[model samples]
Target: MENKMNRRGFFAAMGKFMGLAAVAPAVLGGVFSNQANAQEKRRSAGPGASAVAGSMVDVNDPIAKAVKYVEDFQKSPASKGNKCATCGFYAKKEMHGATEVGTCTIFAGKLVNANGFCASWNKKA
Candidate 1:
Protein backbone atom coordinates (compact mmCIF):
# COMPACT_ATOMS: atom_id res chain seq x y z
CA MET A 1 0.00 0.00 0.00
CA GLU A 2 2.77 2.50 0.78
CA ASN A 3 4.60 1.70 -2.44
CA LYS A 4 1.45 2.16 -4.54
CA MET A 5 0.70 5.55 -2.90
CA ASN A 6 4.27 6.80 -3.61
CA ARG A 7 4.04 5.79 -7.23
CA ARG A 8 0.73 7.59 -7.73
CA GLY A 9 2.01 10.75 -6.04
CA PHE A 10 5.16 10.76 -8.19
CA PHE A 11 3.16 10.43 -11.41
CA ALA A 12 0.78 13.21 -10.43
CA ALA A 13 3.68 15.58 -9.69
CA MET A 14 5.35 14.72 -12.95
CA GLY A 15 2.17 15.33 -14.91
CA LYS A 16 1.64 18.76 -13.31
CA PHE A 17 5.23 19.79 -14.06
CA MET A 18 4.93 18.70 -17.69
CA GLY A 19 1.68 20.56 -18.09
CA LEU A 20 3.26 23.79 -16.80
CA ALA A 21 6.29 23.34 -19.01
CA ALA A 22 4.13 22.96 -22.09
CA VAL A 23 2.08 26.08 -21.28
CA ALA A 24 5.09 28.33 -20.48
CA PRO A 25 6.30 28.65 -24.06
CA ALA A 26 2.84 29.53 -25.36
CA VAL A 27 2.36 32.21 -22.69
CA LEU A 28 5.78 33.74 -23.38
CA GLY A 29 5.14 33.69 -27.11
CA GLY A 30 1.86 35.56 -26.66
CA VAL A 31 3.53 38.23 -24.59
CA PHE A 32 6.25 38.71 -27.17
CA SER A 33 3.70 38.95 -29.98
CA ASN A 34 1.73 41.61 -28.11
CA GLN A 35 4.85 43.66 -27.55
CA ALA A 36 5.74 43.44 -31.22
CA ASN A 37 2.28 44.58 -32.24
CA ALA A 38 2.39 47.58 -29.90
CA GLN A 39 5.78 48.56 -31.28
CA GLU A 40 4.43 48.37 -34.82
CA LYS A 41 1.49 50.64 -33.97
CA ARG A 42 3.78 53.19 -32.39
CA ARG A 43 6.10 53.16 -35.37
CA SER A 44 3.27 53.67 -37.84
CA ALA A 45 1.82 56.58 -35.85
CA GLY A 46 5.16 58.39 -35.55
CA PRO A 47 5.49 61.38 -33.22
CA GLY A 48 2.48 63.52 -34.07
CA ALA A 49 -0.17 60.86 -34.36
CA SER A 50 -2.36 62.36 -31.65
CA ALA A 51 -2.23 65.89 -33.03
CA VAL A 52 -5.76 65.44 -34.31
CA ALA A 53 -8.32 63.20 -32.70
CA GLY A 54 -11.12 63.23 -35.26
CA SER A 55 -12.19 64.06 -38.81
CA MET A 56 -10.25 66.75 -40.63
CA VAL A 57 -11.75 69.90 -42.07
CA ASP A 58 -12.07 69.91 -45.81
CA VAL A 59 -9.72 72.36 -47.47
CA ASN A 60 -11.95 72.64 -50.55
CA ASP A 61 -14.90 73.81 -48.48
CA PRO A 62 -15.36 77.53 -47.94
CA ILE A 63 -13.35 78.57 -44.91
CA ALA A 64 -14.58 82.13 -44.85
CA LYS A 65 -15.63 81.90 -41.21
CA ALA A 66 -12.31 80.55 -40.15
CA VAL A 67 -10.37 82.90 -42.39
CA LYS A 68 -12.26 85.91 -41.15
CA TYR A 69 -11.38 84.96 -37.65
CA VAL A 70 -7.71 84.99 -38.50
CA GLU A 71 -8.03 88.21 -40.46
CA ASP A 72 -9.59 89.89 -37.42
CA PHE A 73 -6.69 88.86 -35.29
CA GLN A 74 -4.21 90.09 -37.87
CA LYS A 75 -5.87 93.48 -37.97
CA SER A 76 -5.70 93.84 -34.21
CA PRO A 77 -2.70 95.68 -32.84
CA ALA A 78 -2.48 93.14 -30.02
CA SER A 79 -2.06 90.40 -32.60
CA LYS A 80 0.84 92.02 -34.40
CA GLY A 81 3.22 89.43 -32.94
CA ASN A 82 0.89 86.45 -33.39
CA LYS A 83 0.68 83.96 -36.22
CA CYS A 84 -0.76 80.50 -36.75
CA ALA A 85 2.64 78.86 -36.33
CA THR A 86 3.11 80.48 -32.94
CA CYS A 87 -0.46 80.22 -31.66
CA GLY A 88 -1.26 77.97 -28.71
CA PHE A 89 -4.53 77.12 -30.40
CA TYR A 90 -2.82 76.23 -33.66
CA ALA A 91 -1.89 72.66 -34.43
CA LYS A 92 1.87 72.57 -34.80
CA LYS A 93 1.98 69.23 -36.56
CA GLU A 94 -0.02 67.94 -39.50
CA MET A 95 -2.82 65.51 -38.66
CA HIS A 96 -1.97 61.83 -38.68
CA GLY A 97 -3.58 59.73 -41.44
CA ALA A 98 -4.28 62.99 -43.26
CA THR A 99 -1.13 64.95 -43.80
CA GLU A 100 -2.98 67.73 -45.59
CA VAL A 101 -5.03 68.66 -42.54
CA GLY A 102 -3.90 70.55 -39.48
CA THR A 103 -5.23 70.44 -35.90
CA CYS A 104 -6.14 73.04 -33.29
CA THR A 105 -6.08 72.70 -29.57
CA ILE A 106 -9.19 74.84 -29.16
CA PHE A 107 -11.05 72.82 -31.78
CA ALA A 108 -10.75 69.50 -29.97
CA GLY A 109 -12.04 66.45 -31.85
CA LYS A 110 -11.96 68.22 -35.19
CA LEU A 111 -9.02 68.67 -37.54
CA VAL A 112 -8.70 72.20 -38.84
CA ASN A 113 -8.11 72.78 -42.50
CA ALA A 114 -4.48 73.64 -43.15
CA ASN A 115 -5.58 77.06 -44.33
CA GLY A 116 -8.35 77.48 -41.79
CA PHE A 117 -8.24 80.09 -39.07
CA CYS A 118 -10.21 80.90 -35.93
CA ALA A 119 -10.69 83.71 -33.40
CA SER A 120 -9.14 81.76 -30.54
CA TRP A 121 -5.68 81.88 -32.06
CA ASN A 122 -2.94 82.82 -29.65
CA LYS A 123 0.83 82.90 -29.98
CA LYS A 124 2.72 80.20 -28.20
CA ALA A 125 4.68 81.86 -25.44
Candidate 2:
Protein backbone atom coordinates (compact mmCIF):
# COMPACT_ATOMS: atom_id res chain seq x y z
CA MET A 1 0.00 0.00 0.00
CA GLU A 2 2.88 2.40 0.81
CA ASN A 3 4.50 1.69 -2.55
CA LYS A 4 1.22 2.35 -4.37
CA MET A 5 0.81 5.64 -2.50
CA ASN A 6 4.35 6.73 -3.46
CA ARG A 7 3.74 5.95 -7.12
CA ARG A 8 0.46 7.87 -7.08
CA GLY A 9 2.13 10.86 -5.48
CA PHE A 10 4.88 10.84 -8.11
CA PHE A 11 2.32 10.63 -10.91
CA ALA A 12 0.28 13.44 -9.42
CA ALA A 13 3.34 15.68 -9.17
CA MET A 14 4.27 14.96 -12.80
CA GLY A 15 0.72 15.61 -14.02
CA LYS A 16 0.68 18.96 -12.29
CA PHE A 17 4.06 19.87 -13.72
CA MET A 18 3.03 18.81 -17.23
CA GLY A 19 -0.18 20.81 -17.00
CA LEU A 20 1.72 23.93 -15.94
CA ALA A 21 4.30 23.43 -18.67
CA ALA A 22 1.62 23.18 -21.34
CA VAL A 23 -0.02 26.38 -20.10
CA ALA A 24 3.25 28.36 -19.85
CA PRO A 25 3.66 28.96 -23.62
CA ALA A 26 0.04 29.97 -24.06
CA VAL A 27 0.32 32.39 -21.18
CA LEU A 28 3.54 33.91 -22.54
CA GLY A 29 2.08 34.20 -26.04
CA GLY A 30 -0.95 36.00 -24.68
CA VAL A 31 1.26 38.42 -22.79
CA PHE A 32 3.38 39.21 -25.87
CA SER A 33 0.35 39.60 -28.15
CA ASN A 34 -1.22 42.02 -25.69
CA GLN A 35 1.96 44.05 -25.52
CA ALA A 36 2.25 44.27 -29.35
CA ASN A 37 -1.39 45.28 -29.71
CA ALA A 38 -0.99 47.99 -27.10
CA GLN A 39 2.04 49.42 -28.86
CA GLU A 40 0.25 49.46 -32.23
CA LYS A 41 -2.76 51.13 -30.72
CA ARG A 42 -0.61 53.77 -29.06
CA ARG A 43 1.17 54.60 -32.30
CA SER A 44 -2.04 54.93 -34.31
CA ALA A 45 -3.58 57.09 -31.58
CA GLY A 46 -0.59 59.46 -31.37
CA PRO A 47 0.48 62.65 -33.21
CA GLY A 48 3.03 60.89 -35.41
CA ALA A 49 0.41 59.38 -37.68
CA SER A 50 -1.66 62.56 -37.95
CA ALA A 51 1.33 64.81 -38.46
CA VAL A 52 2.72 62.78 -41.33
CA ALA A 53 -0.65 62.50 -43.03
CA GLY A 54 -1.42 66.20 -42.84
CA SER A 55 2.04 67.45 -43.79
CA MET A 56 2.55 65.24 -46.84
CA VAL A 57 3.85 67.18 -49.84
CA ASP A 58 3.21 66.71 -53.52
CA VAL A 59 5.99 64.98 -55.46
CA ASN A 60 6.01 67.79 -58.05
CA ASP A 61 6.01 70.61 -55.51
CA PRO A 62 8.98 73.02 -55.78
CA ILE A 63 9.70 72.09 -52.21
CA ALA A 64 10.32 68.63 -53.58
CA LYS A 65 13.00 69.85 -56.00
CA ALA A 66 15.56 67.80 -54.18
CA VAL A 67 13.50 64.71 -54.92
CA LYS A 68 13.69 65.49 -58.63
CA TYR A 69 17.40 66.09 -58.37
CA VAL A 70 17.89 62.59 -57.00
CA GLU A 71 15.88 61.09 -59.85
CA ASP A 72 17.85 62.98 -62.49
CA PHE A 73 21.10 62.04 -60.82
CA GLN A 74 20.19 58.39 -60.82
CA LYS A 75 19.79 58.42 -64.60
CA SER A 76 23.01 60.33 -65.20
CA PRO A 77 26.62 59.10 -65.16
CA ALA A 78 26.21 59.23 -61.39
CA SER A 79 23.68 56.42 -61.55
CA LYS A 80 25.90 54.54 -59.17
CA GLY A 81 25.93 57.62 -56.95
CA ASN A 82 23.73 58.51 -53.96
CA LYS A 83 20.13 57.37 -53.56
CA CYS A 84 17.30 57.80 -51.09
CA ALA A 85 18.09 54.39 -49.65
CA THR A 86 21.61 55.60 -48.86
CA CYS A 87 20.53 59.03 -47.63
CA GLY A 88 20.19 60.03 -43.97
CA PHE A 89 16.79 61.62 -44.59
CA TYR A 90 15.35 58.50 -46.21
CA ALA A 91 12.67 56.70 -44.21
CA LYS A 92 12.81 53.03 -45.26
CA LYS A 93 9.22 52.21 -44.40
CA GLU A 94 6.09 54.20 -45.15
CA MET A 95 4.44 55.82 -42.15
CA HIS A 96 1.29 57.80 -41.53
CA GLY A 97 -0.20 58.93 -44.89
CA ALA A 98 3.17 59.15 -46.60
CA THR A 99 2.99 55.78 -48.30
CA GLU A 100 5.23 56.72 -51.21
CA VAL A 101 7.15 59.31 -49.26
CA GLY A 102 10.19 58.78 -47.07
CA THR A 103 10.37 60.70 -43.84
CA CYS A 104 13.38 63.01 -43.85
CA THR A 105 14.98 63.39 -40.45
CA ILE A 106 16.29 66.84 -41.41
CA PHE A 107 12.91 68.04 -42.72
CA ALA A 108 11.43 67.70 -39.22
CA GLY A 109 7.63 67.84 -39.63
CA LYS A 110 7.75 67.13 -43.38
CA LEU A 111 8.09 63.73 -45.03
CA VAL A 112 10.14 63.59 -48.24
CA ASN A 113 8.30 62.13 -51.18
CA ALA A 114 10.10 58.86 -51.96
CA ASN A 115 10.57 60.13 -55.53
CA GLY A 116 11.86 63.41 -54.10
CA PHE A 117 15.51 64.31 -53.55
CA CYS A 118 17.39 67.05 -51.68
CA ALA A 119 20.85 68.57 -51.22
CA SER A 120 20.94 67.04 -47.77
CA TRP A 121 21.17 63.55 -49.29
CA ASN A 122 24.11 61.63 -47.89
CA LYS A 123 25.41 58.11 -48.36
CA LYS A 124 24.69 55.77 -45.52
CA ALA A 125 27.90 55.26 -43.57
Candidate 3:
Protein backbone atom coordinates (compact mmCIF):
# COMPACT_ATOMS: atom_id res chain seq x y z
CA MET A 1 0.00 0.00 0.00
CA GLU A 2 2.85 2.34 0.92
CA ASN A 3 4.60 1.56 -2.36
CA LYS A 4 1.41 2.28 -4.31
CA MET A 5 0.93 5.56 -2.39
CA ASN A 6 4.54 6.68 -3.09
CA ARG A 7 4.13 5.91 -6.79
CA ARG A 8 0.92 7.90 -7.01
CA GLY A 9 2.56 10.89 -5.16
CA PHE A 10 5.56 10.80 -7.50
CA PHE A 11 3.29 10.67 -10.55
CA ALA A 12 1.28 13.62 -9.22
CA ALA A 13 4.44 15.70 -8.71
CA MET A 14 5.71 14.68 -12.16
CA GLY A 15 2.42 15.64 -13.76
CA LYS A 16 2.57 19.07 -12.10
CA PHE A 17 6.14 19.59 -13.25
CA MET A 18 5.21 18.61 -16.80
CA GLY A 19 2.35 21.06 -16.82
CA LEU A 20 4.60 23.88 -15.65
CA ALA A 21 7.27 22.94 -18.19
CA ALA A 22 4.80 23.07 -21.03
CA VAL A 23 3.42 26.46 -20.01
CA ALA A 24 6.65 28.16 -18.87
CA PRO A 25 8.23 28.71 -22.29
CA ALA A 26 5.21 30.44 -23.75
CA VAL A 27 4.84 32.75 -20.72
CA LEU A 28 8.54 33.54 -20.65
CA GLY A 29 8.61 34.15 -24.42
CA GLY A 30 5.83 36.69 -24.12
CA VAL A 31 7.60 38.47 -21.27
CA PHE A 32 10.85 38.61 -23.22
CA SER A 33 9.10 39.77 -26.36
CA ASN A 34 7.44 42.64 -24.52
CA GLN A 35 10.77 43.69 -23.02
CA ALA A 36 12.39 43.62 -26.45
CA ASN A 37 9.64 45.78 -27.95
CA ALA A 38 9.93 48.29 -25.13
CA GLN A 39 13.69 48.46 -25.50
CA GLU A 40 13.33 49.02 -29.23
CA LYS A 41 10.99 51.92 -28.60
CA ARG A 42 13.44 53.53 -26.17
CA ARG A 43 16.35 53.04 -28.54
CA SER A 44 14.51 54.45 -31.53
CA ALA A 45 13.23 57.35 -29.42
CA GLY A 46 16.67 58.92 -28.98
CA PRO A 47 17.67 62.19 -30.74
CA GLY A 48 14.64 62.71 -33.01
CA ALA A 49 12.22 62.55 -30.08
CA SER A 50 12.59 64.80 -27.04
CA ALA A 51 10.39 66.70 -24.66
CA VAL A 52 11.72 69.92 -26.19
CA ALA A 53 12.88 68.81 -29.62
CA GLY A 54 11.29 66.78 -32.38
CA SER A 55 12.28 65.60 -35.82
CA MET A 56 12.12 68.64 -38.05
CA VAL A 57 10.22 68.50 -41.31
CA ASP A 58 12.11 69.41 -44.47
CA VAL A 59 10.66 71.70 -47.16
CA ASN A 60 10.95 68.78 -49.57
CA ASP A 61 9.01 66.37 -47.39
CA PRO A 62 5.88 65.13 -49.13
CA ILE A 63 3.52 66.57 -46.55
CA ALA A 64 5.44 69.81 -46.47
CA LYS A 65 5.21 70.10 -50.24
CA ALA A 66 1.51 69.33 -50.19
CA VAL A 67 0.92 72.04 -47.61
CA LYS A 68 3.34 74.50 -49.20
CA TYR A 69 5.35 74.72 -46.00
CA VAL A 70 7.93 77.47 -46.04
CA GLU A 71 10.68 77.80 -43.49
CA ASP A 72 10.56 81.56 -43.88
CA PHE A 73 7.18 83.23 -43.83
CA GLN A 74 8.40 85.93 -46.21
CA LYS A 75 9.15 83.31 -48.88
CA SER A 76 5.45 82.59 -49.30
CA PRO A 77 3.43 85.70 -50.10
CA ALA A 78 0.20 84.20 -48.71
CA SER A 79 2.08 83.22 -45.51
CA LYS A 80 3.36 86.79 -44.99
CA GLY A 81 1.03 87.58 -42.09
CA ASN A 82 1.07 84.13 -40.45
CA LYS A 83 3.54 82.48 -38.12
CA CYS A 84 3.67 78.92 -36.84
CA ALA A 85 3.83 80.12 -33.23
CA THR A 86 0.50 81.88 -33.64
CA CYS A 87 -1.01 78.97 -35.55
CA GLY A 88 -3.55 76.73 -33.84
CA PHE A 89 -1.76 73.63 -35.10
CA TYR A 90 1.68 74.45 -33.65
CA ALA A 91 2.89 73.61 -30.16
CA LYS A 92 5.84 72.52 -28.05
CA LYS A 93 8.13 75.34 -29.15
CA GLU A 94 11.86 74.81 -28.62
CA MET A 95 14.96 76.61 -29.80
CA HIS A 96 16.61 74.98 -32.79
CA GLY A 97 19.74 76.75 -34.10
CA ALA A 98 19.05 80.48 -34.32
CA THR A 99 15.28 80.07 -34.48
CA GLU A 100 12.62 78.42 -32.34
CA VAL A 101 10.81 75.39 -33.67
CA GLY A 102 7.43 73.94 -32.80
CA THR A 103 5.44 70.85 -33.64
CA CYS A 104 2.74 71.25 -36.28
CA THR A 105 -0.34 69.06 -36.21
CA ILE A 106 -0.32 68.88 -39.98
CA PHE A 107 3.18 67.41 -39.81
CA ALA A 108 2.94 64.96 -36.95
CA GLY A 109 6.13 63.89 -35.15
CA LYS A 110 8.09 66.75 -36.67
CA LEU A 111 9.05 70.31 -35.87
CA VAL A 112 8.72 73.50 -37.85
CA ASN A 113 10.43 76.79 -37.27
CA ALA A 114 8.20 79.06 -35.18
CA ASN A 115 8.46 81.56 -38.02
CA GLY A 116 7.64 78.94 -40.64
CA PHE A 117 4.34 79.15 -42.41
CA CYS A 118 2.13 76.54 -44.04
CA ALA A 119 -1.09 76.60 -45.98
CA SER A 120 -2.84 74.83 -43.10
CA TRP A 121 -2.12 77.65 -40.69
CA ASN A 122 -5.03 78.81 -38.54
CA LYS A 123 -5.09 81.67 -36.09
CA LYS A 124 -4.84 80.43 -32.53
CA ALA A 125 -7.73 81.25 -30.25
Candidate 4:
Protein backbone atom coordinates (compact mmCIF):
# COMPACT_ATOMS: atom_id res chain seq x y z
CA MET A 1 0.00 0.00 0.00
CA GLU A 2 1.17 3.55 -0.65
CA ASN A 3 2.10 5.68 2.36
CA LYS A 4 -0.09 8.67 1.65
CA MET A 5 -2.82 10.79 3.18
CA ASN A 6 -5.93 10.24 1.09
CA ARG A 7 -8.71 12.88 0.95
CA ARG A 8 -10.65 11.35 3.85
CA GLY A 9 -7.57 11.00 6.04
CA PHE A 10 -6.48 14.55 5.19
CA PHE A 11 -9.90 15.91 6.10
CA ALA A 12 -9.94 14.00 9.40
CA ALA A 13 -6.53 15.39 10.38
CA MET A 14 -7.60 18.90 9.45
CA GLY A 15 -10.74 18.56 11.55
CA LYS A 16 -8.71 17.57 14.57
CA PHE A 17 -6.34 20.46 14.10
CA MET A 18 -9.14 22.93 13.57
CA GLY A 19 -10.99 21.70 16.64
CA LEU A 20 -7.92 22.11 18.84
CA ALA A 21 -7.25 25.56 17.37
CA ALA A 22 -10.79 26.62 18.09
CA VAL A 23 -10.62 25.52 21.74
CA ALA A 24 -7.10 26.65 22.50
CA PRO A 25 -7.87 30.33 23.04
CA ALA A 26 -10.67 29.73 25.54
CA VAL A 27 -8.65 27.16 27.46
CA LEU A 28 -5.51 29.28 27.51
CA GLY A 29 -7.47 32.41 28.43
CA GLY A 30 -9.01 30.77 31.48
CA VAL A 31 -5.63 29.53 32.67
CA PHE A 32 -3.97 32.92 32.21
CA SER A 33 -6.92 34.80 33.71
CA ASN A 34 -6.69 32.80 36.93
CA GLN A 35 -2.97 33.55 37.21
CA ALA A 36 -3.49 37.26 36.57
CA ASN A 37 -6.24 37.47 39.20
CA ALA A 38 -4.09 35.72 41.76
CA GLN A 39 -1.18 38.05 41.02
CA GLU A 40 -3.45 41.08 41.39
CA LYS A 41 -4.72 39.83 44.72
CA ARG A 42 -1.20 39.27 45.93
CA ARG A 43 -0.28 42.80 44.95
CA SER A 44 -3.29 44.30 46.71
CA ALA A 45 -2.72 42.33 49.89
CA GLY A 46 0.51 44.27 50.67
CA PRO A 47 4.23 43.74 50.12
CA GLY A 48 4.44 41.07 52.76
CA ALA A 49 1.52 39.08 51.38
CA SER A 50 3.79 36.87 49.26
CA ALA A 51 5.01 34.70 52.12
CA VAL A 52 1.43 34.02 53.07
CA ALA A 53 0.61 31.92 50.02
CA GLY A 54 3.34 32.36 47.45
CA SER A 55 4.93 29.28 45.96
CA MET A 56 8.18 28.21 47.53
CA VAL A 57 11.34 28.45 45.49
CA ASP A 58 12.62 25.02 44.52
CA VAL A 59 16.30 24.18 44.89
CA ASN A 60 16.25 23.57 41.17
CA ASP A 61 14.93 27.02 40.35
CA PRO A 62 17.32 28.82 38.00
CA ILE A 63 18.12 31.72 40.29
CA ALA A 64 18.08 29.49 43.34
CA LYS A 65 20.77 27.28 41.79
CA ALA A 66 22.85 30.24 40.74
CA VAL A 67 22.89 31.47 44.34
CA LYS A 68 23.27 27.92 45.73
CA TYR A 69 20.09 28.13 47.77
CA VAL A 70 19.46 25.47 50.35
CA GLU A 71 16.23 24.85 52.22
CA ASP A 72 18.09 24.05 55.43
CA PHE A 73 20.84 26.31 56.64
CA GLN A 74 22.73 23.47 58.28
CA LYS A 75 23.21 21.86 54.87
CA SER A 76 25.03 24.94 53.67
CA PRO A 77 28.30 24.92 55.54
CA ALA A 78 29.52 28.04 53.75
CA SER A 79 26.48 29.97 54.93
CA LYS A 80 27.90 29.93 58.51
CA GLY A 81 25.32 31.32 60.91
CA ASN A 82 23.30 32.68 58.00
CA LYS A 83 19.77 31.94 57.00
CA CYS A 84 16.85 33.66 55.39
CA ALA A 85 15.58 34.71 58.78
CA THR A 86 18.72 36.77 59.41
CA CYS A 87 19.74 37.65 55.87
CA GLY A 88 19.49 41.24 54.74
CA PHE A 89 18.24 40.01 51.37
CA TYR A 90 15.44 38.21 53.11
CA ALA A 91 12.09 39.90 52.94
CA LYS A 92 9.15 39.69 55.34
CA LYS A 93 8.71 36.42 57.18
CA GLU A 94 5.21 35.00 57.38
CA MET A 95 3.53 31.80 58.39
CA HIS A 96 1.86 29.71 55.76
CA GLY A 97 0.01 27.00 57.60
CA ALA A 98 2.59 25.86 60.17
CA THR A 99 5.62 26.38 57.92
CA GLU A 100 7.78 29.48 58.27
CA VAL A 101 8.51 31.15 54.94
CA GLY A 102 9.81 34.42 53.60
CA THR A 103 10.93 36.09 50.37
CA CYS A 104 14.41 36.76 49.08
CA THR A 105 15.71 39.64 47.01
CA ILE A 106 17.31 37.11 44.70
CA PHE A 107 14.07 35.22 44.20
CA ALA A 108 11.16 37.61 43.97
CA GLY A 109 7.58 36.31 43.71
CA LYS A 110 8.65 33.17 45.51
CA LEU A 111 9.00 32.17 49.15
CA VAL A 112 11.92 30.61 50.98
CA ASN A 113 11.80 28.86 54.31
CA ALA A 114 13.27 30.71 57.27
CA ASN A 115 15.88 27.98 57.70
CA GLY A 116 16.96 28.32 54.11
CA PHE A 117 20.37 29.76 53.20
CA CYS A 118 21.90 31.10 50.00
CA ALA A 119 25.09 32.68 48.73
CA SER A 120 23.42 36.05 48.59
CA TRP A 121 22.82 36.05 52.33
CA ASN A 122 23.91 39.24 54.04
CA LYS A 123 23.74 39.97 57.75
CA LYS A 124 20.55 41.84 58.50
CA ALA A 125 20.97 45.05 60.46
Clash count, one per candidate: 2, 3, 0, 0
Task: Please give the RMSD of candidate 3 to the true structure.
Answer: 9.1
For each candidate, the alpha-carbon lDDT, in order, equals 0.59, 0.62, 0.82, 0.83
Q: After superposition, how far is residue 33 of candidate 2 from its true place, in Å?
A: 13
Per-residue lDDT tens digits of candidate 3, residues 22-109? Answer: 9999999999999999788656545434443457889999989999999989889998689888998877455767788877778776
lDDT of 4 by residue, 1-125 (tens): 24455877888999999999999999999999999998876776667545344789999988889989999999989988788999887766568787788777778778899989999888999
- Return the lDDT, model 3, position 24: 100
TM-score of each: 0.43, 0.39, 0.56, 0.58
lDDT of 2 at 53: 39
Candidates 2 and 4, the one with greater TM-score? 4
User: What is the per-residue lDDT of model 2 for residues 1-125, given as tens digits with 9 covering 90 to 100?
Assistant: 99999999999999999999999999999999999997886575445333443365554667566544444345544445656656765664454453465556755555555644556677766
| Error at 63, model 4, angstroms | 1.0
Candidate with top lDDT is: 4
lDDT-wise, the better of 1 and 4 is: 4
Error of 4 at 88 (Å): 0.9
Could you tell me how far off, in angstroms, the CA of residue 51 lies in candidate 2 after the best superposition? 4.2
Better of 2 and 3 by TM-score: 3
Task: Give the TM-score (vs. native) of candidate 4.
Answer: 0.58
TM-score of 1: 0.43
Candidate 3: residue pairs that collide: none
Using TM-score as the measure, the top candidate is: 4
Model 1 score (lDDT): 0.59
Better of 1 and 3 by lDDT: 3
Cα-based lDDT at residue 74, candidate 1: 50
Where is model 4 poorest over a 10-residue stretch in terms of lDDT?
44-53
